[model samples]
Target chain A: MAYELQYYPGATSVAENRRKHMSGKVEKLRDISDEDLTLVLGHRAPGSDYPSTHPPLAEMGEPECSMRELVEPTPGAKAGDRIRYVQFADSMYNAPATPYFRSYNAAICFRGVDPGTLSGRQVVEARERDMEEVAKFQIETEMTCPALAGLRGATVHGHSLRLPEDGVMFDMLDRCRKEGDVIIMHKDQVGRPIDKKVNLGKPMSEEEAAKRTTIYRVDNVSFRDDPEVIEWVHRVFDQRTKYGFKPE
Target chain B: MVNSSDTNSSDTSFLQLEVSPSRLLKPETAQALLNEIVELEGIIRLFVHGPGLPQTVPYGPAKGEPVHHPANTLIEVGGQTMELAVYVGGIRLEVADADVKEQVREVCERVLPVPFEFREGHFIPTRQTVTDYAKRGPGADPVMIGMTDPKGKLKDHPVCILKSESKGND
Candidate 1:
């Protein structure tokens, strides 16, 4: 008999959010057009054919490998598309998604992805078309809040900094700005100006963000508040410390 | 533009007005808050603090591109026009005494509708440090002590001197 897979061990909403995110069952909050997402990504121009690194897998004539036959290639891998990346910086101020959570979500949900998580930013790299689909899904889903999360290819500052008066995360490049109720991205992720502004839907309210956040903050649902999470964390810490050193 | 002569005033008490971390102050709001506080008695020095908004992209692929941040603009504060290089999140004030601190707190209460932290402590340096000595030299202006980075250019960190019940603009 197969055992049930529990993503996280906690009774708090923060843990629940983490589990939901890791399970890839998050709600879709907005519908950003593919064209707008592509423009902001800046990896390729809108409606342009994806530049390929090599011939399609079907045409390349692969060797007789059991592993290659067993594993199905992603659409991008099949097409031999160039590798591209999409990076996100989520604010520390009760953002819906955190860097580690974003990486975990990508690893669990996406196929053939290279997800990297830092203290403040998360980057996921895949073939061009696959990366686009991943970026669009993450941007349109509840995991992202326009004001608190930013698409930054470089100079990903302001994740831990205070929000500006406009209630938007500070970007040194000034890629996105708050326009009344919604946030608009006029510059691409790398700070290059796009032809037209992309309208990221309205940001979530502060109260809603707090409720949906996966972070464990003292003011909110802290780590200490969840005993099960604490126990699991201690077990992991103990295992890593005790068995990390093995004589060669 | 603060000079050593202006440091003669005996405003020893220090207080910091920190706005809520969730939001920074807009230029207009910062101006209003500064204007209100400058008019109050006992304030000798005021320093605005927050993350900087660089004029140009400091690094990365688009390094020379203009930032053009809305917060990085000129604002009129205490009858003087100066550039606000950062998003205003906190203000450090050197006042005369406890009574003046109260008055300043009252002014801040009136000016800022959002929740703020009014802290009375040594938030500003009372004397120049070694960095100041190395950068500004022996005859460094006492009034401008500890307010800026020693290695940075003086023009980048302009100090506005607003005398109580006076018309001079420094």
Candidate 2:
């Protein structure tokens, strides 16, 4: 199975929103549901309750989960609600997942908080901070640590990973984090980071979402050495392929 | 632009921030919050208990100080392991001069408290108040902190570092 790490607002909504004024330019958008491995990040449906002066545009939503409640004005919090989640993007997690297990794909997630305003540059910077903050939460303590929980991909740059100059990349990100940059992923655009943008104006039923494409809600993650974890990724990949929409 | 790998030191420290709940800040009142913080700089001494924490923050009372409001936390001071950003601590700085507060408030997000005089700023600890109700945990400093460097100069309250022995082991 192929998996890619993505950033927020990168995921456009499968459901059309009236308030957003979207013109169907975005295609292959995935559903941010519990069932699908992919998720919708900062990009939200019209009428989403999130506050405007939100910390950083990148932080509104994305692969980060612990922050879901504090920042994201997600619809009612329930078991059925889709979370700010992501997908594996590629076969990186396939057999012999350990080597790949040491790292995660770095992605740049962004969103226009105002929707009416905010230049692309501002959105990019916000993502930088969000990524940094995520790193802090990871190394600082396990209480709200992303590492302690199911690992989530952060937006750190991964330019020279071992496979592609990997050692230097990981070191660089760790260095950035120490300097307080909060480098999460070791590289940039290593793999696909699933993105889901929701436009609230026009909502889609669960059936509509399920019918659109293949999704595998990441139920779990663990040490690649742990055979069960590796086996599970394979199972989820199978399920994703079973229900996932393959590109034509 | 220092990288983490360059550092040979293992000692790491984090900053602790406390927004006076007494202000009764609301998510909507971004401007008031910024104003209150700036104003507090003048009467900063009046607010601190040990006279150390409050003294660490810098007071910019110039009638015509250049406006300083960053949309994101920019690094104010950076060294091997030490860093100080006016907004690095996740506290948002609000200035009434440029209408920065108003623009930030339009969003539903909480505005972070901003800082000034970072490297030269005071050494603010993690916790401020102590109660008989709360349990003291490991890694917490226990002392009636004051503003004095090891040399006994009343140089600055917050920045003055006292040895662990000086603080007295409880």
Candidate 3:
């Protein structure tokens, strides 16, 4: 705790943006109401009570444990809310946040959260209310560009694929549509039609995306350009490979 | 857009015009590109390829729902209206020779909105492969040799523009 923790090391904007994400310092880009976010999440109906997996922690007396006494349960856990998840698929073309960075941000910023990262998508699981909060923050922040990043619970196939001519990320489900300059979400994460369309504001231009993105693309800021990050990565890789095996 | 009267025996060289940024082309742009290139000289056959846009959602929770993609629309190419099923990433043309390839490149530079690579190699196979022989059998037309997918039905792959000498293989 004494020494300052460095989230990432590089001289480029991409690296700086990555550090900003990990440090939970992302700029809030849009204002999405809680109701709109809840509808997009599709876990429960808006204004409905969060379903519970167990009774409230206070009602059901806990067993005497030193760890339980020292560690405080999150509000969602204390209220016995059911576990729920929010998943995202980001495009490879200068999207603000990629799968790994999404996971890193979630791990650093949120509590009682389980973040899963894949090649194309990132999923964060928490108690229903807790996940709603996390999803809302992610949706309303600069971390997500409506055109390049999408909320997709399943069939998240567009990350590595090409963007359409209009520059919107390809979604097989067609969950979001580009109307004029803004991107609108007509369907929930699982591809079910929602009652009201959610306006996700205007998508970032190529110049803006290149400046804000955390991804190190060859066209934008290539990974090879940052020698400090490369050296650190190679050091880790070398150590892991050399010492990975035990004495024969 | 196929001319039924044209036989494709003499079509030897292949050229592919790959759109840069590797994105799917909208119907309007695809139609424009097709209309421009199909009128050029020495082009025997033309084929468009990219990831498919299925009519119905192919997988996941909304599998049966209509895709309603903007790209999946009827496009008129070479005065013939046909359903465009895939995002036209690259337009492969079977030209008469190398000179025709250069002509095609010039036309592409003029018509294409985005940057493209005018590749001069065999982008698509001209001769029938063993898989095609096994799946399509010997009775298959020589022209349809490598143009049509062996597994996919002909109805599925509807974008075939065949220009003959009498009309416009310009």
Candidate 4:
């Protein structure tokens, strides 16, 4: 069967996390809106006392970030930002079928991002940092096997991406897709982390697409596969990708 | 090749000329070689000489047992280090601490010719172990010691090794 690969960096990042509220892990929530997501910037854990992977609900020794935040990268997130984490899911390593947060098994929630200017400019800077990391991971994965070989040159059909593989890694990548999940993805910005403000309350569903004032502009979300590679991939992707999205 | 008898001196010495690389090595080169030998000897004595590395599994059946071993690179031939030698066994290299020794032991058992009986005492140590035991209280197991002349025999120099100590403990 032909593989239907979806490479949505933002959504895929929170594969194991979209259900934070369902698990009863977050507490003392303030301004938990789409805008908050952009302000938060990077991955964060929830509880300070929870574990290394989670952000502290209150000020604790460990980084207080959410599991979802950790799954994505917020390279520009500063120390003073209030963060909370519950669990962390990392699919970059090990098998793809098992979608858990990460090794810490904790999640994070955050408020009061960096206290610095939480503007679109700040968010873009933060998002760029995260994307570079994911791009680097894509490179490393390509080196390990060929399935991800031509990622930088592949075509993006909506959110879908087609990368060249050496059978083994492609088999794994094929198994990457899950059931009942609508994955929107793009490898062009695969590892690149983005600060997005996709309003959950927005009329994104067909039921609300008509007469819906809430416009959902799908911003690209990047993964911080490696801290160092996040920026490197941005430069490389610009040179590698065939798309004509030049600097406006 | 000249025999040991050629070393004979005085009292009607017979001159049987035999070619040796010594002719080309020269005294300065020889001195440099000698200096290298001394430096290597110092390294071995300090690290590889004794039990090479003292492995004591506290509360294990052979708790105080010392294991002597040499790196495969330093072949023990007639109690001398040999540059060239075929090793029959593997060197189960590993990092060990309180928590990870069991894992290290499993690796060692597979590589070393010794059997894998932790409490039953199944480990053939190197000559280095003999000296290590002499330093620690008294007689350690014999297998811990290595061969005498490993070049032709098992030189069994000590197992020269050390590890970075962890946090807290001095």
Candidate 5:
């Protein structure tokens, strides 16, 4: 019989959202220009050549390794690209993609990706060009809420802070500001002011965010309310304990 | 002849109106609320506290540049001009009795557009503290005890005493 894979098991919306994100089934919501994405990332200039660390793999001539012959190299790896990183700070207040979920999505959806999940922020490091492609997916998909998630390389203190009167997450660096309805980024991720502002489209309404969020809060969809998830957690815990002590 | 000790004997209470998960109230709303609340009788001292708005960008590439927060500006309260440094998060009042507390609540309901709760407690230090003596030096004015910002230099007095001007327009 052909094997079928399951993402997550639960009937609740929060669990469903987790499954969708893990399976990369979320619909693309917005499109950010390559120039804007590069500017916000602050890694290199929009039109500048990606600085390579070594000669291209094609020119270098590969050593006799069976594993290297079996697996195909990524585009950046072929070009001997330098590894770069992009970090996102997701708000705890029902942001669509939390740190853990972001890492899960990257692990399942992309290859040659290194995802690190922190308490307030998540980082993905890959070859420069590859990282930009991943960042574009993250920014343009339902994975990010413009007001709730921030592209901050440092000073990621606003994840748990209360939203400002304007409803956007608090950012001491003031990298982004709301103009009428849309959020605009006026600075790079590292807080250096940029020459032009990148318009990030309108933020989702409270109702939409609540519906799309993967977080389980008592105020929203509580984790305890999902019996399937609770049972699965218990089963995993029991199996770990049972197998840890005595092996068959 | 009255004894000198009798002058110090009196009951006083403080009232605090705090906006939990502090929000930045508009400058106009803050001004209007202050004007109405300060006019009530039995309210002796009024102080507003919240997140400070620095005059300049403290760090990053924009260091030393002026921070243009709309809430951080000069406001007229009870005809007295005062500069607001912080977003109005809480208002502490030295009220004479419970009756004045009720009056303040009425004013809050009519003026404040955000959520707020009032509690009766000693919100400010009534007596001189050790820091006051250490920071202000000896012979510091008793009136400036809990009023001044400790982080601010001696020249920058944060305390403002509101006064009514007979000819001033509202």
Candidate 6:
């Protein structure tokens, strides 16, 4: 008999969103060009070659190990691409992905990934090309809300602050802003002004955001409303506590 | 600190109106509200507070560059010019009596499109602090003790006194 896999426990919409993101089942809503993605990332130029940290694996060679023979090297690894990162600052006001969920999505869905979650922001680091692919998935899927999340490498305040009068997330760097109804990135993640304005589609309406958000808030779908999730949390805690007390 | 006996005998209370859809208030909305409230009797002072807008991109790769925000501009209020730095988070009204407070509430309800939570409390310091002396010098007016800007030069007055014909009517 084969065992089936489960992502998360809950009956609410938020929990469902969590399951979808973790399983990589989310629908891609927009297609930002490779050039535009690279522009906002600001790691390297749009058409520039990825800088290498070391000689390619084909040239440097490898040690004789069974594990190394079985596992295939990723394209970035084969090319000896330098490790780079993309970070997101998600708003506390029902942003599509919170810090923990972002890390979970990255860890479960991608290969050669290193994800770190902080209080207000989440970071995913990988070899340059791999990182760009992951960043595109995050930006295009239901994982990101253009108005509620920002691509920020530094000075990432305003996650907990109220949204500005324009209904866009507060960004001190002003890396992205609304042009009419469309949200455009006129600056890179680090606040360096860019020559071209990358158009990120129109922001989600408040109603749509609430429906798609993975966060459980009392104002939206409360966590307490999901009995299965609560029970699972308690069960996990109880097992950890009991196991810590004595090992059989 | 201003001596408790320094201020006039009028009972002063702060009426704080916290607006919803809290971010992104238009300057026109603020202007309309101010024009209405400033004409009401028994109102001693008006102050607007919210997130501060820095003149430059204070940090990161674009440090020292000008920050262009639509909300950060000069607004015309009651025929007086007022510079708005932050998105108007809330408006604080210092009223002399219950009658004036009621009038202010009515004005807010009529002017503001979004719902607001009305609170009565001491939102600002009534007395002077050591920082005031350091910033405003020794000859600072007692009435303006707590009103001076902390970042402004010693010679700069925090609050501008607008001379309008409506001032005498109030």
Question: Cα RMSD to native, each candidate?
Answer: 3.4, 23.9, 3.9, 24.6, 5.3, 3.4
Which tens-of-lDDT digit does each residue in A93-126 have in candidate 1? 9999998889888899989899998999999999
Q: In order, what lDDT does every prediction score?
A: 0.83, 0.24, 0.81, 0.24, 0.78, 0.80
TM-score ranking, high to low: 1, 3, 6, 5, 2, 4
lDDT of 4 by residue, A1-248 (tens): 99854321222323323232223232221123322332222233222221233333334454556874566434323222323211111112121111121111112222222212211101111122233232222122211111111221111111111111111112111112111322111111212222442221111222322111111123212345333344555766976774766687
What is the CA-based DockQ of model 6?
A: 0.44
Every prediction: chain A TM-score: 0.97, 0.21, 0.97, 0.18, 0.96, 0.97
Q: Supply candidate 5's per-residue lDDT for A165.
A: 68
lDDT of 6 at A89: 95
The digit string of per-residue lDDT tens for model 6 on B6-105 reads 5422333434333333554677787788788877776766677766766677776667877676677898865768788777767765676677778888
Q: Which model is ahead, 2 or 6, in terms of lDDT?
A: 6
lDDT of 2: 0.24
| Among all candidates shown, the one with the greatest TM-score | 1
By summed lDDT, the worst window of 10 consecutive residues in model 4 chain B runs over B41-50
Candidate 5 local lDDT, B1-170, one digit each (tens): 22323222133334434333244466687888888987887776667876666666666445665545556789998777989877665777667677888888888888877666777776656555566666756656444556666677767765665642321111
Stretches of candidate 3 exceeding 4 Å from the true structure: B1-22, B158-170
TM-score of every candidate relative to the true structure: 0.91, 0.18, 0.91, 0.16, 0.80, 0.88
Error of 1 at A50 (Å): 1.0
Model 1 earns a TM-score of: 0.91
Local error of candidate 6 at A4, Å? 2.4
Indicate the TM-score of model 2: 0.18
Best by DockQ: 1
Evaluate every candidate with DockQ and list the scores.
0.60, 0.01, 0.52, 0.01, 0.20, 0.44
Proportion of native contacts found in each model?
0.71, 0.00, 0.61, 0.00, 0.10, 0.49
What docking grade does candidate 4 earn?
Answer: incorrect
